[model samples]
Target: MTLEQARAALAAARRVAVLTGAGVSAESGIPTFRNAQTGHWARFRPEDLASPEAYRRDPKMVWEWYAGRYRNVTHAQPNEGHHLLAWLERDKGDGFFLATQNVDGLHARAGSERLVELHGNLSTARCEACGTVAPLPEPNTFTPPPTCPVCGARMRPNIVWFGEFLPELALEAATRAFEKADVALIVGTSGQVYPAAGLALETRRAGGVVIEVNPDETELTPYMSYSVRDVASRGLAALMGEG
Candidate 1:
């Protein structure tokens, strides 16, 4: 649909749910998970480094990979898409919700309050044994791997790995938001990741108007009420009447 049509749909909606993927953060210079392997990491598979077994076999290596990612994400700023969503949340209050598959903390950094980080955030570390969560140490000081000071067990990035389940609370919250939304805004995601990708379908099935913002068509294109073919920042800005 055209920008004006998309904007009118958004403006008329009473409740809105927004789902974001790595594409949203790409504008801020953070690479998507699959594209993050480069330099010394080019030789290794990303899945090999992200699984629980990878940590059991080589904790230091896994920790190093995550540490680098954390450092990279920490330096990146939120893009206009993130800012616009934050504004929507502030304007709509309880009527707005955000669900994101990206581990980067850009949404929170951009001032989004009602949000679910479906894949977890890279800025925090979780104790594998006791489940305690804590902020990750600075990259330069994160040597010898991080150990849980409370349980003396290994600490892993607070991220969902290849075979792992998404956080339960986040999943439930996202589902509820999609179920009740008058409009569902999908941004930057290719719709390849499941469970998270399923939210768009859930919203559609629930009879909500689904709008997709991406430069190219995605698996979700067929389900969308409107597909805006533009990058995340530009697409979201246009939708919010900022462009």
Candidate 2:
């Protein structure tokens, strides 16, 4: 499809679904977890700090790692890419749905409410006993392993560790949106990770317009209706007719 066709699809479509990934976060200066590691953390692999087995082995260590990450994200500012999606959400309202592989909470800070964190986020703690999720304490005052306010049980970082399923409700909502969308915007993803990839495929199967925005062609590039070869901020700006 031509660039005009891509823009027309976005402008005319009533229901839109968006999927975002690490490249979006990177634009805001938030490094991927592996890349964020430094000093003592640099020695460990991602699985060492992010797996259920690792948390079970030493919950403190895992929580501490996440605590550092929480601090990192809180210190960073949301970029134009984040704000544009949030603005798009305002225009689309209930017709919009956003699902992100990122866990930094930048989208939330940028004013997106109709969204889900596919991989969970670092801004909160989940009650191990009661399942209540609560925001973490202020960065400077927080210590590792916050306790649950609801149950007084030990609260773990509100993250989906390896070997865990994405929250069922979140996954189902994102899937439904993709399946029914008229346009699906996939931004900054490698397209290697499933079910994020699966969402794009769902859009394809439903005969929806699938637009991918990335600097390089991705695994799903072959399936896209069109691709914008640029970074998230520029690509999304172009899509919104603001570039």
Candidate 3:
């Protein structure tokens, strides 16, 4: 469909739900986790660094890798896609929700209040001993990463690892959001991951419009009601009647 048609669909959508991925943050120059390893980390695979087992075996190494990522996230600004979605959420009030797979906290930084971070936020750390979550200390604030103040247990990045399931509450909220949405904006995702990919299918089955924004065709391309072949920021801008 044309840009006009997509815009019209968005304009008519009262309960809009958006699903974003790493591509949105890529617009802000933040490297996706799979591509972030560099310099001394060039030899280690992502799976080797992001798993719970990895953290258990070498907490210092894993923490160092995520510290580098946190620095990048702290410096990265939200792009056009993030701003426009925040605007849409504000305009729709309680009728809007954003469910994102990214752990960078960019959506929260973008001023999206009604958002669910499915993968958890990388900027926060959870106490492995007590499960209390807290913001990671600023760079240079700690020597070997901060331990939990309450229990003195090591703090791990509050991110879902390979073996961990998505946070139950966030997943439930996302599911409910899709159920109530009149339009589903699937942006920047490859549509290959399960559960998240199922959201798009759920929207389609529920008779909601599925608008996909990506630079290339994805696994869900065939199911999209309106597919815009552009990068997340540009495509979302055009859909919102900007670019």
- Candidates by TM-score, descending order: 2, 3, 1
Return the lDDT, model 2, position 121. Answer: 88
Q: lDDT of candidate 1 vs native? A: 0.87
Worst 10-residue lDDT window for candidate 3 reads 137-146
**Tens digits of per-residue lDDT for model 3, 127-239:** 98999998987865745567897899988888898888998998888998887789999999998875758898888899989999999999999998999999998898888
Q: Candidate 3 — which pairs collide?
A: none
Best-fitting candidate, scored by lDDT: 2
Superposing all C-alpha atoms, what RMSD in Å does each candidate have to the true structure? Answer: 1.5, 0.9, 1.3
Off by over 4 Å in 2: none
The worst-scoring run of ten residues by lDDT in candidate 1 lies at: 137-146
Q: How well does candidate 2 match the true structure in TM-score terms?
A: 0.98
Q: What TM-score does prediction 3 earn? A: 0.96
**What TM-score would every model get versus the actual structure?**
0.95, 0.98, 0.96
* Shift of residue 66 alpha carbon in model 2, Å: 0.5
User: Which structure among the candidates has the greatest TM-score?
Assistant: 2
Candidate 2 colliding pairs? none
For model 1, how does the per-residue alpha-carbon lDDT over 138-212 read when each residue is reduced to its tens digit?
766766457887989978888999889989998999999999898999999989887656888888899888999
Model 1 spans > 4 angstroms off = none
